[model samples]
Target: MPPPPPSVAGGGRCILSFAALRDRCFSHRFLAAGLRPLAVQLPVGGREDPHTTVHMWVPASPPRNPLLLLHGFGASATWQWYPYLRPLIAAGFDPIVPDLLFFGNSCTRLPDRSDIFQARSIKAAMDAIGVTRFGLVGVSYGGFVGYRMAEMYPDAVEKVAMVCAGVCLEEKDLAEGLFPVAGVEEAAALLVPRRPDEVRRLVRLTFVRPPLIMPSCFLWDYIKVMGSDHMLEKTELLYALISGRQLSTLPKLSQKTLIVWGEQDKVFPMELAHRLKRHLEGNSRLVVINNAGHAVNLEKPQEVCKSIIEFFQEPAYEASNEEKV
Candidate 1:
């Protein structure tokens, strides 16, 4: 016979939480993949007095083709990009994955929370590591940061591959019903969830088919660990990225760009992808994956990987190479 379950099943919940923590641990898996943790002190938010610390996982050897992977709003960079490390490395690209300020080990007390600031911080971090130029792959929230980086430092960021980044989205979209939520408050509730049910909503919004059996204890654990950090700042980042934004003012990229979107994405919607592709004016390719949602990277990792690999590997974007996707 078995001993009875702990009161309220606390023991099982603790085990699940511990497992989640272990699984989300970035250092172990990345270190095993030949990457190392690097903490660089740099001036962020364009201020000198309040220096921010940027943490990253990078290869020990200089990369022949370096690529920066920026994660979205959910978990840390490792949680989002771990699946791509081996595949990217095998493709002869050294992947630089960073926890943008307020995520993972990176933090700042300066209070500025804008994608431009995030971009500048990342560029400073790369310079400290002696990497003059590299490619970039940013998903969701990371796509906002990556877009700013590509805009501010075109020479440094040679090529860009954005997955479901709503760079072309105008602020009016929220009030105009282009978004799933009405405004930043509701958006924050989903992106920076504090409760178990909020996590459920996020999962539903992200995936084409969210898991049917998400244990409440696991959601609570994930919230306490992954989704609860730097709440005010993360919310500010969202407002900074979205509020008063207009595509007419958005700068077009000089480097070749690759835009990937899930056909069923409800968060930013498929129109934003088309808007971004058109905003690029030219020299950009859009690939829409079927049966995927906002979290296309996680749902269709192989297709996303193949698109990025081919994007960077290809020398130029021929008109003939463009697809209606």
Candidate 2:
């Protein structure tokens, strides 16, 4: 899982390079390289007049079933899916990528409590946009939110997919060995990388098998978009959220669930996926993408997307034939 060498795929700016700290500027440029931007409003604590700002990316499609994309900790909705938005649109799914409150361009201020509260705002956003009963896709921390959604509103979520989800783990099991705690700067520092090299190292640590390398530019951009302070705050908040929680409840989720993980994923490792599968009931499946790492979506979006389409399509298509009678 060592850092990957730089890769340029016919673009204005090359991928972020970790060659030198001075090349960090490219990170900013990379973050701004999106096709479209969306502005959304979510009511704050049940009030209509005052709403929190959430940035989004809505794909152009013929209004197929909605797909809610949730990002990992310290990531905005856009960054989680990144360059994959355009391709998803081309495939017939309406991808709704939203900044989950505190991360990215949404609200920078910490929510004062937990991301659990942010889920309510997400539901509000869905209601505002006239979307209900859609597929849910969450990565890392966002995966937890997806789990909560499926658990709370079984009827509203048609399918649930978790990619490299952040699990409630023992303190000793983490890379940093300390659970993030809000208001504690040190713990936050441990979770995020301040330098480009550190970012590469982190990516390596999380992705173990396929030798997937995060171009230094990717790390550089990641670090710049998520400044040190913001990274720390998110880390603290996330740590507090799952520090002592039990993850056993998630497997009991009734929605058609798919636990997708990269075989080489160092973060939530493939073994964890196996552990999770044991707890899950109903129509649930575990898929391991070969030669991929923790950032499975980024490393292999098409493969992941294909699995998603097939997984969701089967049940609905079967039901339609049944109704034809």
Candidate 3:
């Protein structure tokens, strides 16, 4: 029989278990406020549904072309790809930023394990939005999604880019420093920050390099609506990747691919970029940003944007070869 449940702080109404609550506190310590509600989704699951929190941001005057932007782990779509979206729009490209289901504000309180579900939901969202052929860009965790997308639907993606993405966890130990939890209990224990100051401190250490100050009221607001209270979902996703059990599958990526990495990034690191470059089956290029960490898109937006633009504008080799002949 299941062991007697521990005392729940918010009464039986709270769907989260004691272990879930503990893990949420521990794991959520690094998630920043500016990156909540990754995007919006349709009315699919009820309050209990797992894919509720996914959202999308469409820029004004969306060009005939559309660019999809996926965010990093535990970050909202807007926060993760903010640099690219605005500039991409200004440059006459339609940019779409969608928060994956579990992380941001698409909905709260998903089942303890929902990465696969999130992936399917994201695909559904793209279909719903009528995204046919478009460029795909993913940062960090989002890069994993982009890689999978390129692998799964090679014909659909015009180009692919991974910015400081965490891929190949099974083949390598890139994510060694991302999560600090030793076990399930230790994971849950990080969900609740004792005070707002603690939250800020954790954010600075894990996410922001120079530390972007969030308003005090905003911190309190985030704590109130805090979803993703269970850390295991994320852990399970990582475990699946690390164990080589589950990740977006790519047989032979034919799309043009660009990989970007922050030279100083500790999470995925420069080696990850190198390894991914070696693995991709399509034409690919690598760009390393100096003095930047995992959040290069945010820390050095212009540089990142410049790289993207140059990549996009550079004519495909086939096109150039045909012209030359």
Judging by lDDT against the true structure, name the best candidate. Answer: 1
- Model 3: number of backbone collisions: 23
The predictions' CA RMSDs to the true structure, in order, are 5.0, 7.1, 10.7
Q: What lDDT score belongs to each candidate, Candidate 1 first?
A: 0.81, 0.61, 0.57
Better candidate by lDDT, 1 or 3: 1
lDDT of 2 by residue, 231-282 (tens): 5456656566655555553446777677788877666656666656656633
TM-scores for candidates 1 onward, in order: 0.91, 0.74, 0.67
Mind giving the per-residue lDDT tens digits that candidate 3 earns over 150-236?
A: 767767778887788757443323234433444333333333343456456545533435435454444443444443333446556
* C-alpha root-mean-square deviation, candidate 3: 10.7
2 or 3: which has the higher lDDT?
A: 2
Candidate 1 stretches with Cα past 4 Å from truth are 1-12, 24-26, 43-51, 319-325
- Predicted candidate 2, C-alpha RMSD: 7.1
**After superposition, which runs of candidate 3 have C-alpha atoms over 4 Å from their true positions?**
1-53, 59-63, 107-116, 171-208, 212-232, 245-252, 317-325
How would you order the candidates by TM-score, starting with the best? 1, 2, 3
**Which pairs, if any, clash in model 1?**
none
Using TM-score as the measure, name the better of candidate 2 and candidate 3.
2
Write one digit per residue (lDDT tens) for candidate 1, span 217-304.
7777777777677888888888888888887888888888999999999998999988887777767888888888898998888889
The clash numbers for all candidates, in the given order, read: 0, 8, 23
